[model samples]
Target: MTADTDATDAGAAATDVTEPGATPTATDTTVTPATSAHPGPDAAAPAARSGRRRRVGGGLAVVPLLAFVALAFGIPALAMLDGAFTVKDPVTGASSYGVANVTASVQGAYLTALIGSVKLSAFSAAIGVVCGLLLAQAVVTSRSRVLREAVLTASGVLANFGGVPLAFAFVATLGNSGFLTRRLDLTDKGWSLYSFSGLTLAYLYFLIPLMVLTITPALEGLRTQWREAARNNGATNAQYWRHVALPVLAPSLLGGFVLLFGSAFAAYATAAAMVGSSIPLVTLQIADALAGNVLVGQENVALALSLDMVLVAGLVMAVYLPLQRRSARWLA
Candidate 1:
């Protein structure tokens, strides 16, 4: 019996060892609970691929707008630049490249037209600044929200309200046979609608509104505390404006003026409609040059004038951008 018990014990020990080292079945080969619960590389790879796809989709969305701008604004600008230096041969009708057209554009009647545009822009912008500042200040100082909202809304609309329609409105209001003109009979007083003075007067319609839109925020930025502090320091209202307000608002005011100057300088349709060929504006001269009315085959001169206008506008922006940043520092 002792021998038999030893044999059975030995058999049990052998069975235990074999069971612990047994091969897995088909069920064990399939994913276990822990293995299924924790995903592996294949599972995470799809997530990474989806994230990449989202980024690529976002990039593709901007392509249409970029293409549009390249075709619309970029292509036109390049064409104008190329045409500016190109001179067409009168004999062969072939195009040759030279800066002679540019030189010609900068002298003679074209020069006069450029100067006129500058003077008109300067005069209009100056008047608009002063008048618009007053209007903006008045609007800001008002107690009524209705007044402020109404003024701002009107200003926004009027600021963008230039072109042939604006010209027509001014004509109906102040032309020789117009309502106000007929009522006032301003022609007897040396008033003429088809003149530079009349064009400047019409330009003020939109210019003042533009100034108001630009300057209203700056005027509002003039804190009540500053005025109160000035008054408490025994400074009069006039003194406050001269010392405190003027200095504080100078950058914004000047920036607004520069913006207005550029607006007036680039204006073509309104000036064209109002003055026609009577006044010699650079824009009008350009139209004439392009239409082959003044010296045929001088289309390059038109492009040169356009280049000059672009340069002027560029210079204005260069000055205005720095002043604008400075103004934001104070307002912020």
Candidate 2:
């Protein structure tokens, strides 16, 4: 009886074990392979493909802008380059490529005009940066929104107010026998409205407003916390500005100067109307060259001058862009 019981118990235990090639019961659990948490090469391929497609689409969208730039700026630049290098003889109508025009553009009257333009631009930009920075600070610190808006609106209007009308306005107010000139007796003081000093004053009229506009956003970007932190660190107002504010603002100030310099350098109409050919300026020189007022067949020289201006502008941009990038990193 004991042997029979042992054999039956062993047979029961053997029946409970699952064997190979046997069907699994309803309650039997099967083991599965573990999955990784991170995405594999195959999983990331679609995302990479999607990013590539977006880049391609963005490139396609920029095609029209590229075409416009080619037509508007590139073609003109190429023509100017060709004209600048190509010399045409007046006697025989013969044409040759050389750097004569470029060379001539940097000598004699051209050289004087270039120097004058640089001086005027530098002076005006320096003054404008100072005055504009002060005015912007005032506007930014004001409690009245109406006053701020009014100044900003006036600045916008005045900044765009240039050319013939601006020249006329200045002449009417400051010219010989004008209302202000007569009342103030400015002529007796040897103040000539058509002189270099007068031109600089006129430039300031617009440059100040432009500076205000350029620097206002930067002024507003100054954080209250920065001031509070400086005060907490036992810094006085002057020390705070010297150590912190000026350093942070230096880039923006430089950028504004570049902007003003470029504006003053390229200005033609106001100077032409106010001072005529009395004051030497690159823009006036260019006009004289193009209109054949100074000499016949000097258009190539004008193109060369244009090239010089473009190079100067490019240099200014090179400086400005880096400063702008640095300013953005801090302010943003």
Candidate 3:
């Protein structure tokens, strides 16, 4: 009786340890191997852990992108946009704010500047595109790799050489009493550093490089076969360009010019330093309003000027929109 009781307790212990997924033991006589049904609790655990890991990895990926956009673009935009609404007073300690600040005189000044800005920007971009395309064409076709490398490097350096230092360089080189003018003694050649010609010349220094950089990819996208096919069919250079290359290059040319125009339009530092009140840019006019006589409702006029700049920028962007869509495949 004692031996039988010990065997029964041992069997009960085995039943408790053996989960539903466990196979019947060789010594068991009742339960069958083919009749096992349920999965053990441990079976689903690895799958759940894998899913958790995937979620964690995905979340980690977005952190850097959000941080980058916020750090670079988000902060500065808020500052500029806020300035358009705030009203400052000279006599009073505090200032008022609202979009009701736009005035007629300011609006007219804005419209005038807008016109000049558009004209100059368009001129720069047109020149830049034509010159840039030719330069790109020359660079890509050259057999001399050394020349290509040197030209590309030089273009990059010159393109970045703008703002205050660039202004200084121009003053030193082309100013009435400057070295180049003295060296060439071209004072009698009828050139003026304070003139539109000078500004356009300086602008091209940066613009050409931008054009070269931007249009190189487009030029490269043109296959040798396209030219060969055209030539095989007796297509003249003008004919080929008219029928094929111009269509492809049109979007890029237009887009690049529009961007150049916008850059020239709001350019304050270069124009202010170079021309001052001697040549009244729209930007310089607006800047003058904020410097002194801040009271007596001039704040509204300044705000109006600011809005004009915004509208000008918007028009440039509107032109950019369709060009982007047109160049989507090749430009992409």
Say which candidate scores most in TM-score.
2
What is candidate 3's CA lDDT for residue 177? 85
lDDT of 2 by residue, 124-239 (tens): 89999999999999999999999999999999999988889999999999999778999999999998999999999999999999999999988888899999999999999999
lDDT by residue for model 3 (7-94), tens: 9999888775756777867654466568447655687788888999999999999989988998886775565556566666667857
Model 3, which residues run further than 4 Å from truth?
A: 1-60, 67-83, 86-98, 104-110, 183-185, 293-304, 330-332
Query: What's the distance in Å from true for residue 324, model 2?
Result: 3.4
**Between the candidate structures 2 and 3, which one is better when assessed by lDDT?**
2
RMSD of 1: 8.8
User: What value of lDDT does candidate 2 attain over all alpha carbons?
Assistant: 0.94
lDDT of 2 at 185: 95
**TM-score order of candidates, best first?**
2, 1, 3
Query: Model 1 residue 92 lDDT?
Result: 91
